[model samples]
Target chain A: MTATDRQATGATWLRRNRQVVAPVLFLLPGLLFFLVYVLLPVAQSVQISFFRWDGLGEPDYVGLANYRELAGDRAFEVSVINNVKWLLLYLLAIPGGLFIALFLNQTVTGIRLYKSLFFFPFVISQVVVGLVFTWFYDPTFGLLNAILGAVGLGPVNVLGDPALATYGIIVAGLWPQVAYCMILYLTGLNAVDPEQVEAARLDGAKGWRMLWYVILPQLRPATFIAFVVTIIGALRSFDLISVMTNGGPFGSTRVLSFYMFEKALGEYGFRMGYGAAIAVVLFLIMLVFIAYFLWSMWRQERGA
Target chain B: MKTAWTTTAALALLAALPATAQDESLSGTLTIFSDMSNPAPRAVMEDMAARFDEMHPDLEVELTIIEREAYKTQIRNFLTANPPDVANWYAANRMRPYIEAGLFEDVSDLWAEPEIAENLASTKSALTVDDKQWGVPYTYYQWGVFYRADIYEEHGLEEPADWEGLKSNCQTLLDAGTKCFAIGTKFLWTAGGWFDYINMRTNGYDFHMQLTNGQVPWTDERVRTTFANWRELIDMGAFIDNHQSYSWQEALPFMVNGDAAAYLMGNFAVAPMREAGLTDDQLGFYQFPLIDPDLPMAEDAPTDTFHIPSGAENKEAARAFLRFVVSPENQTLINGGDALGQLPVNAASEVDEDKFLEEGFEMLSANAPGGIAQFFDRDAPAEMASVAMEGFQEFMVFPDNLDDILGRLEQARQRIY
Candidate 1:
């Protein structure tokens, strides 16, 4: 407010250019926090990957020894295969969510309640979801086995059987994931341009055709978000697997993230270097996808 | 000099302080990190800590109890960064890495000075690494086959003495529509218990130790014989149906309901079985049946310890706490409950009136002349133990894969050791 105070402050250009200066000042704290927490840890994890550390002492430089060990590990193989299965099967959520969203999109009585009810699993903690699904899949006294028994079929130990455990967990994970995607699609549908739809309808775009061309194109943002989250959910599948199976019934249900955690922190003795190597592998996997996504987005922006 | 004058002034100020404050009676805030998070054990620990506080009224103890799984990971980090004065840990190889890294302090003086070492000689060997004790092993429990006494009585099954006795008992139990054993390999460690017992009984204590310590290869003949005995149990349908589907805790229903005859587990299991409505007379403790008959028996006894972290600020207070913990009066609190029980390592500790505890004591002394094991996981390196536990679980589910499992174990053993 005073000329003297204004004179004492440096950078007259910044004072004049208030718009740029204010935005940079506002962004500084968030950017600093992001760099410290997320970016720093990621870089540190990458650095740790080269050394054979036990999480407690001086890390020994092992170069590619850990990655080499991972190459031959059966547990690693099983987990990688399981992760692939999770990725492929997890995509079903996008379609499943859209279907449920469209079904409940109508103005029926108690529609809001129905929508909320369908989204219930997503609202519940993952730990609770895992426990519920575990009891549901219990061989002796579970709902699934009870149903199987009712149908004159033998009781199948879904979580116990190595061949079936991963599938059982993925199905449990999908329950809430579908709900997430459904909510995204519902919100996207609410934002759909009514006039564009009217024009499409007048042009005889109806049913599957209308949804495929007119409606889905409008829900692109939602679909992109759903895909991103579903992929993340698949890759970092830890809590559900931890609660339901604990990578057990002979370590069949472990994913890359859970395996990394086990090697790094679990009582398998601290193998921090090996765990870091696994994390680096997983990061590289996600990086490839992210880089492609960013490239594609950049292309889209340029075209637009 | 100005520095000398400042030093003189500071010294004069210190000299003017109260004499009582400088007394070595340990009257400061003592921080303790404990992993006794289970309701019963945690209660026993709290009771012991409260007793310590009462005994030394001036010393205020701040006890922080961490959950078991999280504690294992956090303890290492805490020991490095900000350490509690006293911390609970496991003995043997579990403490070896910490001791070697100098994370845990060598409290050999406490063992020597107070003559507490003589009282707990049985546990001294376990807490000792490099001929020096790093911890005070306060508690451990016996592991064996817990059977339903009534079921055994009805079946005319005398306590199984050898492979034949065990086989006949299993046959009779199966004939009577009762499963021979209730094993839950879902957690995988339960199978390790079975492997330890059979390996020790078949090859004797020395061979079992050598094998677990990775001196003997998994492809060795003694291991094959051990697995052969294990295979016999598998072939006879010894374990309850779908044993793989349940955790050790979940498998208790079979024993409690009399659907299964016995469970090979630690003494901690008695608590759950009692909670599940089994009476004292109904529950019976017995060492696992002998396999070689010539070889001596060894029981699985996992010891829990308390140690002083090297970075402790209150070394004196931590030692004082350990002194209290090692007392026979405090050890008895671990056995106060009707069901939940852990045997105190202190030889002078009052014996429990509980029949199962008495039986455990008697069995441990009489049968385990060859020596006692610290269970499979505790006995072997954690890395190797994990692999072995997994392999054993797999073998339990698929008995025909013994050779493959053994080969895989050998590969892992070679990689680790």
Candidate 2:
């Protein structure tokens, strides 16, 4: 057959099938992978939450008993309280990042190096960060204790005291998280229109007022991203706690993620069902915030 | 017909390849998941595997040494999916869950072998569950107070034999501005050592076993008494301040530097203690002092064992490896004759001639009305042990929190059981 005839047939076939077939074909691989890996495990976890499985033997069905058990578990209560503290304290990173961003916003000599230096913590892996801070907080000879002793104030066992362990880990997490927010704001600042800023300055907008009304309104996208990531980061704060204290000093440092790990895979011996229930609770928590975040983003997008 | 005859003879030899008993020519890949990832011990383990490989020319052994912490979690998953031929684990309660899950082979027949059985006879009770042997313990070490002899002498503190003597020494040491005990409970298991000693001393070995087995409740008056006795040292400020900030190894500096006088730890800690510049002449070993004159004395001796996974493809090779690991030559090499202070489980082995081992062995075997008990975590279910260890750590940090901690542990005990 002639080349024109083959081309015509191909174009006709594409024109005939582009509407329904193409979209399904495009969605096949990703949809299949998500269903298998993400959705299926979640469903299985929810199912297992009702039983008493040890991850090895047959799961004995004990309907809502694990949840009932959670209600009375002191460790679970401690873990939830610590998670709330983590979420609240982790919000500091958003403002912390903004302050650093504002301070470093000027175009000065060697500012690129300074910006990268400020961004160093985010570049570090959480495990390394945890180790560094763990050494720093060591009560006997740690830098923090050494300084405190010099000042005649503390020698406080920051990572050891039940009252202070979670805060110590959250501060470690914030080191990286603050750096993350700073980078987000830096990029958003770059996108800020210079004309609008100059116009706001002409209208007598200065320092705090300039930041709040003029710059922050324009930096809405960045703030939104920072808020979303900070909240998610707080909930997903496991590695720092794991490396710093292993949810220790009487399990006071345990967030939901770390507590679930201790239950499911730690030397605590398999309580897979209970771990799943913990995971379900954490998921519901994230789901609520996720809905709120999406709603806000949707409102912004509609206006934009 | 003549070719068929020769082929049938060849097939018959192939059928007889894997003999039930000890076969000199067992040929297959033997996979081992070992948790001995330390530099010195891992080198010794690798050498043993190489020598075993050379002895059985056709048998190929694959030794995979995993980081100790990661190995604990990985073993649960790997034992069921694509299991290895051999795996190393702690002997008693640590091995129970897997044994009950049918993940490990019984290994009773290996115990029946006269040579292996004779050397490992003392450990027979440790490796057995339900009247059947489950594993062969290759090495174990003693846990006791390793103290600074020079400091003890300078301060005129005698090695304590009873509660009163220990308290006196602690008081003298405190007056001298030196802490009595150096401990770090950041990882939680270090606290388990204290609990084991307390529980064993307060309520004899049988009671300890019963308590660990869930036959006794945390609310039992006996359990409360153990806590009360431990709280004495805590109230007296005998421990390093802010001990929760250091790991067990990190806390050794206090004892080694003479700021603290004693350490309740395993014999394995000797290497690090020595590495910290403490000489053998400066350091001394003693059993944890007697708490109750009436109760029998029992020490914490955690035995390390090797077991064949039930799903192992080459059982004969796995048994051969176990036999080789427990041999006198391998034990001596791994324990390092008069070097690292580890004790091999093989009774007939010639090593463990060091001062600490000799002293520890005497303390564990000679004066005890009761036999040895595994450490608290090793003796108890892993789940209960975690809660109990956490409670002990909390109690150490806040002595006033004892009742609250015990109440919480009781809640966990009921729920976990």
Candidate 3:
């Protein structure tokens, strides 16, 4: 064919296929990234979990050995239990945030200043938060002990005691987390229908009744987001634990994420297969929440 | 442009000097990845690289000093994908994984050289794995009781000669409202130093070696005996309170402020204590008091080392760099009081006249008749060392939890070994 004739044919084909081609072209980069960065690594992690490897030399297929070892591993048990504690205790931030939001949702002088002041914790890095709380809970000279001593109470060694270490770290985590949830609720409260509040007020609904029946339902989207973020934060609590206690006072502060790192890439940790196994277990735990979240969001979209 | 001019200048200088036969033959880029990121050690490493660069007219020496903590994890990455000609690492089981993976060059020939074979004999076994040497030791430090002499004198207590004497002194110190030892178990390895000294003293060096080598059960009665010895100090509250919350560095203020009388630590502790203003008269060094009179004394002397990656392109340049690192002259210069402030691996090298360095040298060489061990983490496989150190920390905190801790450790031993 002549060049012009071939070009005309190609242009005609492109014109016809533009609708399908354009969207796919637009999606290709993101899809390629998701596949390579997220999906491939996840698949590789699952595959590696079934092997015996130390990040050096060839990996040996060990069937279910790494998982089996995790089942019996005491450190793994402590990590799983601590992860649960983090999940349950971390949820406290949701209500804590809601209360702070309600209190701050006022038409007062410098309300913006108050809101920013309340949101301050979220602005700081988790590392700095961990360090600040570490000093705050210091047994000898910490503010916690200083306050306790004023009341004729204890000079409790919070982080030094395995029983108390995780709780102390959770408190540190909650500071920033509560601030995050507060910001979400503040945004959600702004979108709440004022006419519904007026209607509730005319119906003699106020305080507990108004909040329970009228306000809370309007805050559902924010609550859902808060729950999702809080759950994920609890599951991936590595930095605070690493910074504050480093899974210490004898590994009492370790969560699944921290344990996975300790087994895989920590100073002494090179058990790649075992680390991958822990990652798989953590992924499964997170999967349940993620699947639920996705389903709920899908149902809501359909309902709307 | 600056580098080119310096290279030219260095080449001209090398030509002027009577060049050694080996020096003329070495021509390539020598890359060194070092974890000597501390102020003094970083200077020493940079100086070494510059000197090495200057000595070889045609060879280009490149040095990267990673932060000490970061280098531990990053070494695994670079060794596999982008191997340097020479790299820094610790001795003993710390290097085992790299050796087994064949990432580290078998430098048995370097060890066979008379200069290394004769002078670096003390740390040879530490760098050996599977009957082959993998690296050369450059520096190490003695681990012992770094005590407050003023406090000892105030209490009229002499340096303890045996376990009984040590206990009595601790009792005296405690009675005087001072904690005996200021150790921070927060990092876990500080407790490992305590375990090493007690175990080495109680069961002798051979048993300590076998246990670390994973040939003995954690529940072995001999191990229990070691714990019982450690327990005496724990029960008496010899350690500072809330030690688990402090790092080794954080715990120092206790000794400096006289809240604690001493610390069981490496010679590196001396510099910090001095900086904290403990004069030589106030500060003292003593071999960890003998626990078992008949066992003969063994000591913990963690050796830091250098190795050429097996994947290195310029093995010859790397070997020459390693040789230069361990030569008596360089060893003395780099390990001087102002440099690493640690003992030189080369016996022929002069020990820095710093009080702690001299005392550490004398103890490691003349007094430690039984043997020398790399500290707990270096001697034991990484996984086991971490697990065992955690157990040690727990045991210190809750002495009553000894049985439970030992049971968990035994389980780990079964799994790990």
Fraction of the true interface contacts (Cα pairs closer than 8 Å across chains) found in each model: 0.79, 0.85, 0.85
Model 3, B112-172: lDDT tens per residue? 9998899988888898898999999889999999899999999999999999999999999
lDDT of 2 by residue, A1-304 (tens): 9999999999999989889779999999999999999899999989999988888878899999999989978889988999899999999999999999999999899999999999999998999999999989887678998898888995688988888888888899999999999999999999999999999999999999999988999898899999999999999999998889988888888989999988988777589999999999999999999999989888978998
Candidate 3 lDDT, A163-229, residue by residue in tens: 8899999999999999999999999999999999999999999999999999999999999999999
Candidate 3 residue pairs in backbone clash: none
lDDT-wise, the better of 1 and 3 is: 3
**Models, CA RMSD each:** 5.1, 3.9, 3.2
Best by TM-score: 3
Provide backbone clash counts, one per model. 0, 0, 0
Candidate closest to the true structure, highest lDDT: 3
Query: Local error of candidate 1 at A20, Å?
Result: 3.2
Poorest 10 consecutive residues by lDDT, candidate 2 chain A: A154-163
Isolated chain A TM-score, each model: 0.93, 0.93, 0.95
Candidates 1 and 3 compared by TM-score, better number: 3
Indicate the DockQ of the complex predicted as candidate 1. Answer: 0.65
**Can you list the residue pairs that collide in candidate 2?**
none
The DockQ-derived docking category for candidate 1 is: medium
Segments in model 2 whose C-alpha atoms lie over 4 Å from true places: A1-13, A16-28, B1-23, B338-341
